[model samples]
Target chain A: MKRSIWAGLSGAVCLSALALSGAAASAAPRVELQTDPPLSQIEPFSEPVIFSLKAVADDGQPLEDAILELLLNTPPKTPWLTTDFPVVEGTMLARLTLPAPQGEAQFQQVPPIRGSYQLQVRVSPRVPGTFEPYTDLLTFQVPENPVKYRNLAILLSILLLAGLGGGWVIGGSQPPNPGEVASRPVQLVLSGTVLVAIATLLYISITAERAGAHTEAPTGQDNYTEPLNAEPVPTNITATLEDQAIATVGQAIPLEVELTRAETGEPISAAVLDINTTSLEYERTVFDFTAQTDTQGEFVWEQQFFDGAPHLVTVHVSPAANSSIPFEPFEFSQRIDVTGVAPPLFVRLVSLGYCTGVLALGTAAGFWLRRRSTQHAL
Target chain B: MYSSKLSTLKRAKQGVLSVPVQAILFLSLGSLSLWMLFFSSYPATHNTMHQTRHHTLGVGCH
Candidate 1:
């Protein structure tokens, strides 16, 4: 139950993070940054939490010689030790050690700030390099409960739709219509199905432990990190992600790959980016095939993951394309974690009941109409 | 003869309304009632947590 609560909270955090980042960045520099002990882990009055930042490039490469800057903001209500979140921003960080991979620069921040914290990573080329310094910006927060009772609110809406619709059919129908006789078989089937659904749901409700209602097995990916932006940039290959950060289970989650010239952003219509899905016994491969990009310089491969295992989608852009960017045969991968929570069985059963009841009632309404017409004729 | 003529007129009127037409009309009327009730009560119920929000409010206003 506690795990489920944690998962729900984390999933919400992930959603909000996406919302905060915006769908696409207009001109975000390639320097990627990640801070550990995600904002969700922050609470009021707790010990000053140290947010360790990891810096990398767009490709899966460790970024060295990066400079990190931090500013801590204090607002009202920082309690310093409690995880009650509404209270915890009170602890002061004794020191922050930013890793240069070769050297260290340290700093300290005062506790209990009420505003957002800003972290910036600036990467300077170390090896008498041809590359110029680039910067990436990240904003962190201890978010508030924006909308309380979210699930309960959605459930109320579903029930209202069902109730009003059901009431209409029930109140309108009368006997002695032709459809009443003709629809008997269908009515019987629907009735039986609804009864069975209701009984099964009831049995499960009475028997099954309530742990499934709120256990956190699969953590929500609301952890503030963008692998696409944080990964190491290969010398010659440039790849782009067609976002599917909002896909659900059993639905086709498409990752659109476009090979482009890093300097010009022009599509490499002839380049093929090979895809290999790192998942379960289902070692499926069309995503792994090397195919040429069309005139648009992009192709999409969709995978519908069934079970709740974290799968990494590894994409390798073939280095055959001619480009000014020194392309190494490096690969970039994103993990498709468990983000979707399937509707509970009880909710599904209620939905089934609504559907079956509607069908039967609609038939009855037809019969009632036919009977009225007959009466008028007589 | 007059009665028979009246009956024929009545039959024509009834004939104009086919089974499908009657069924559609009846169902439409039912749905309309539901829609009116739902829309009218939704705002009050949503805020006040009472399904008969309009009814109670109407009583108070009177």
Candidate 2:
């Protein structure tokens, strides 16, 4: 049970890492200088700069409760850049530890006079993981404050639309006119009013939906380091026969090979892995393995082999052309010497094998249920 | 007078033949009602566990 829990956690972390590795640069966490609205130029003293920095863990997991320390260079005219003060030495660091649920930190940095002040923001994680801290340096000026609009235009538009729609609906049933055909003007006016009301309702609903679209904190914003693909560049390949545990001459030994892509290290599926042996008996004993790759480039295979002699395992990795990335062929082998032990002697081994088979069957059933539902939807 | 009496008798026989047609219409209406009720609720009771999110991980694989 504990092993299973560890496996689940590891799987989650692996998926998170893979997702973040492909994230774009704009999604990365960085220090931003915020005014009431965005400013093109910064002037001195007139506007106060609000420093905001958000960090997400490298594993793509949220580091909810972490400490954010702020630092700023003093006096606005310290010769700190050239030689006197290094980046860390001249700045006074303030400890501002933020609690959980917010997972955000903001601070204000003001210089005596804004010439060219460098703002430093650092984030440290408080959880259990090997992660590098995040730091960003941003330079901005204190800009002149622009005249603030009272936002009366937005309010007036809303009220006008509402009043028009309400008046039409509250007027109730139209007067009956059984004696004569309705005139063109009356018909046109009625249709125009109804169309305008419908358009207004649709606009309101669409705007509300757009605003509600952003529900969760942005996962892609964390500056996740890209992965360096380590394709065990095959050097010298060698294999020797190790000790063997064997069954009857006709019985089959199952073997599974999983190959991942070289670039993203994601698993590549349906690529054939070959097995060679000194004797034809060993080679023919090899059964083809099943292939499947999950969302995070992971897969499993099931196959059986039947041979009493030493056997070799070789795996080749390949990817579809349409795939985002391709995998280079990787070859490795393990040799096993077989003694053809009697079937009566391995009761415990057989029982454990049965248990594993049961578990695999259960997993397959779960997958099948999901597949059927998807078909129904289609 | 005798011809008028015979015409009245033929009209009564025609009315008797229309009884089975009325019964057939009622049966058809009942069958239609049963079908609508049964099929409409079938979707409401459908098991959701059978739904799968697995397609060849196209763009959202990560």
Candidate 3:
């Protein structure tokens, strides 16, 4: 009887241990990505490159209903000439769904600039909480296009020469005369041109700011409160905006984010959250900051929108070291409308200064030529 | 006064280029300067004028 009892106890303990190990195994599913032509062979300003991705379980079986999100970021070191161009300096997002037949998906993008590109791949199940999400950061370099650079240099040189030649001939020939009254039409046209130029500059400045036109990393990895863990725990993260319709400039926009266990609805606390606001119109990241969720598994913050436009707010949650409940790192994004406002006085003044400086230089050159012409006449 | 006006007109016409032609040349120069300063894609030129592009023109560059 004593031997039978001991045997029964050992059997129950072994069964419990096996169940826990099985649960842990199911929690860790990995997504593997393969790039065609490989990353090393990618040439700048070349044709679009394809990225092939697959998600697999621990047993090496492909996960058919997996979704992959790819975030391609330009190198932080190099500044792009224009964010308006495709694949220039801003972040590009692509989504891929692995269908049943091949259990793989592909993404294609054209790399226009030459620099180190960081591609962040995040994989999760179609249905939340099936398994812990997986994220991988891959870096690749695109070689500089020597031909493009050479052509650019030649074109700019020609423009510079043309401008200088034109300015010299115009100034030398049409010297300004204080005694000779200018025609009414000529004066009108000159003033009109200056006004139009100033107005255009001001408009462009305001629009560019609203469009979030900057070439900087959306969010730096160093800003994270804690480094992401190798293996994240299974958790579901969700975020909501207080007023989803419209936000006003200079007003505080409230945002709330939470993390919880999908199965048990239990809150997960002490998660590090990276929040970034990107302007959709210009595809530029305007605001990026980091925060932590409170004990109740909630993070609430107020952000003041600078530009009036449609903005995407993205929250990336990662596990914190001292957290009682481990949680998987995941991203949540929401789009909101922001009302526009007039460009500040300083921006207008700067635009005016640029226009005035150009006009003044031209006027000064004309006067100098006029003095020399008058001496010859005398 | 009429002779003075005629002499002034003759002097203006005696220059290498006409007034209209000079105006066009000056406008071309202005256009070229604006394009190079604001819209040039060359890295060296763009990077060199990076601050003026951002602070003065309100064009966003990092």
Lowest lDDT sum, 10 consecutive residues, model 1 chain A, at A79-88
Q: How would you encode candidate 2's per-residue C-alpha lDDT over A1-378 as one tens digit per residue?
A: 999999999999999887877574446655344543244454322233445555565444455655454444432422221111111122332222332223465543222232345556676655645345688776655322222112223323433443333222222213325542333333443455456546544554565466457445644622221113323423322212122234223233333344444445545443433333222222332322212233444433211122233444433344444455444544444444443322121322332333333333433343355445556776
> Residue by residue across A165-207, what tens digits does model 1's lDDT show?
4333333333324524323332343354356446544544443
Count of clashing pairs, candidate 3: 0
Instruction: Order candidates by lDDT, high to low.
Output: 3, 1, 2
- Candidate 3 lDDT, B2-60, residue by residue in tens: 99999988777545235555466346445644654554544444445444543331233
lDDT of 3 by residue, A306-352 (tens): 44556776777787777776655666566666765432334334433
Q: Taking the candidates in order, what DockQ does each have?
A: 0.02, 0.03, 0.07
RMSD of each: 23.7, 30.9, 19.8
TM-score of structure candidate 1: 0.26
How far residue A253's Cα lies from its native spot in candidate 2, in Å, is 73
Error of 2 at A93 (Å): 8.4
Pairs with steric clashes in candidate 2: A27-A221, A43-A142, A43-A143, A267-A297, A373-B50
Regions of model 1 farther than 4 Å from truth: A1-232, A235-237, A280-287, A320-327, A340-378, B1-62
Better of 2 and 3 by TM-score: 3
Best by lDDT: 3
